[model samples]
Target: MATEIATLGGGCFWCTEAVFQQLNGVLEVESGYTGGQVANPSYEQICEGTTGHAEVARLTFDPAVVSYREILEVFFTIHDPTTLNRQGNDVGTQYRSVIYYHSPEQQETAKHVISEMANVWDAPIVTELSPAETFYKAENYHQNYFRQNPLQGYCAFVVAPKVSKFRKTFSDKLKQF
Candidate 1:
């Protein structure tokens, strides 16, 4: 089995973690903080938007079952990459749309996907494509927030919709439960 990692930030980590968890090849989705100078940034520090860290979901997957391009395609679909430093009502640099690629190939694939997705959206794509950085895992409460608190207000109104869209659009890619 070939294992690969993909670190992505698209607004809230809760939303991104929920969406990727349903994918077939994704082994695990860890909510984390990255692309920042802080060694171990707390969620509070991230929320302040001064740590430069974006709330991210680091995914472990098998390339044989899912390609990096496919992961990126779903990412672009679930979040508004055109919006800078925001997704829905969530605002701040920590909520910025970003792709922290693990390899040269992943970086190229992200660039290609971003370009292709630009035609799909009306505004310019502002999603950042950077090399993978030190990922500080988020607090345990955030690990599986959507799954643990589906009825939570933000999860119900925001994360749930993104998960629903991912399910509807990528039904064929879903894992058998």
Candidate 2:
């Protein structure tokens, strides 16, 4: 299968990870930390917001099944991109809206999607666009957290809603499983 990568941070990685995992063509999704100055920032360090790191989702997908633009479309819809360094009650640099693109083509597509989706919100979109950086995988507990702890407080209240939104809005993009 032809695979491409898309790394994005829209609030907590748990939320974004859960959202993208349900999508078709998304072969894998890993929660990670990137777009930061720290070499290996811990979840606590990232939560501190001093490391300049964002909690991001590193996704492996097949472009032939779902284009990067379509991925951005889902990203833009589920999260509030206009608010800087925050999503819902989750506040900090690590919770910021960001797209860590792996290539120039992905960068261009990210910009185009953000521009096209600007009017969808009353405020201007503030999603960050940066070259993909060293991705330090989150601790094992953080991986597939939603699927692992679906009933956990945060997963049940926050992540589940986002996942539901994705499933409802993009039912056509979901895998048959």
Candidate 3:
């Protein structure tokens, strides 16, 4: 099985990470910061919105079972791509909708997906597609946040609903859970 990487930022990494974690061919999802001027930024710094970084999730997936296109399909559905630099209440550049494509192929796929989605969404899709950059894994506490802290305030109120939505909307793509 050929494995590939896809880095994406759609609001909070915890919400983004939770949805991908349940996918059939997704091998791993690392919550991290990317697309920022800051080098090796921390969660606090990224939160401060001074480092110009977005909270992103670096996912490792097997394309044999789940194509990159399918991954993009799920991504668009799980979050609002039209809301520039924000997802729901989470605002700022850190919460911007972004796709850090790993290659030219991924870049094309992302664009095609976005164009197709244009027919679906009434508002313009604001998802930014860029070349992937250095991925600094967030602190251990940020990893597996939804799974580890399902009952936590934000997890329960925000992330969990997104996870449930993904499960219901893309039940066929979901892994056994």
Candidate 4:
């Protein structure tokens, strides 16, 4: 089956990865750092916000089963796009709302989605639409963190709430866990 990849950053990679993992057509959700100047930034480097990288999740999905538009729909619904370089309590460029489009088509889609969201809300869309860059996978401990540490304090208090919201809001697109 033909597949496409979409990389996005809306806040903590844990939250983005967790939300995308539940989608029916998504094959994998890898937490990573992208849109940065560093060759291979570690999580710590990114956290400092000097690398210019955003904590992102690369999603591999079956396009036939879930359109790019649908993916963006879920993305926009999951996080605030109005705040520049921030999401909820997470502040700094690393937590910025961004879409690292893998192709020209993806870039166009990202722009379209942002415009649509702008119409939906009076606030301008601060979500960055840019070409995809080298993605450095986060440290091993960060991958599938929600699945691996469901009861961890941050997982329970932060990630779990976002996952619940995504699952409930996009029930039709969720995969059976």
- Measured by TM-score, the strongest candidate is 1
Tens-digit lDDT track of model 2 for 1-177: 879999999999999999899899999999999988889889989888999889999999999999999999999988999999999999888899999999999999988888888878899888999999999999999999999999999999999999999999999999888
Across residues 1-177, which tens digit of lDDT does each residue of candidate 1 receive?
879999999999999999999999999999999999888989889999999999999999999999999999999999999899999899999999999999999999998888898889999999999999999999999999999999999999999989999999999999999
lDDT of 1 at 161: 89
| Alpha-carbon local distance difference test for all models | 0.95, 0.93, 0.93, 0.92
Q: How close is candidate 4 to the true structure, as a TM-score?
A: 0.96
Pick out the ten consecutive residues of candidate 4 with the lowest summed lDDT: 115-124
Any runs in candidate 2 off by more than 4 Å, and if so which?
Answer: none
Superior by lDDT: candidate 2 or candidate 3: 3
Model 4 C-alpha lDDT versus the unseen true structure: 0.92
User: How do all the candidates rank in terms of TM-score, highest first?
Assistant: 1, 2, 3, 4
Identify the runs in model 4 with alpha carbons over 4 angstroms from their true place. none
Residue 106 lDDT (model 2): 96
> How far off is residue 145 in model 4, in Å?
0.6
TM-score of each: 0.99, 0.98, 0.98, 0.96
Candidate achieving the largest lDDT? 1
Which scores higher on lDDT, 3 or 4?
3
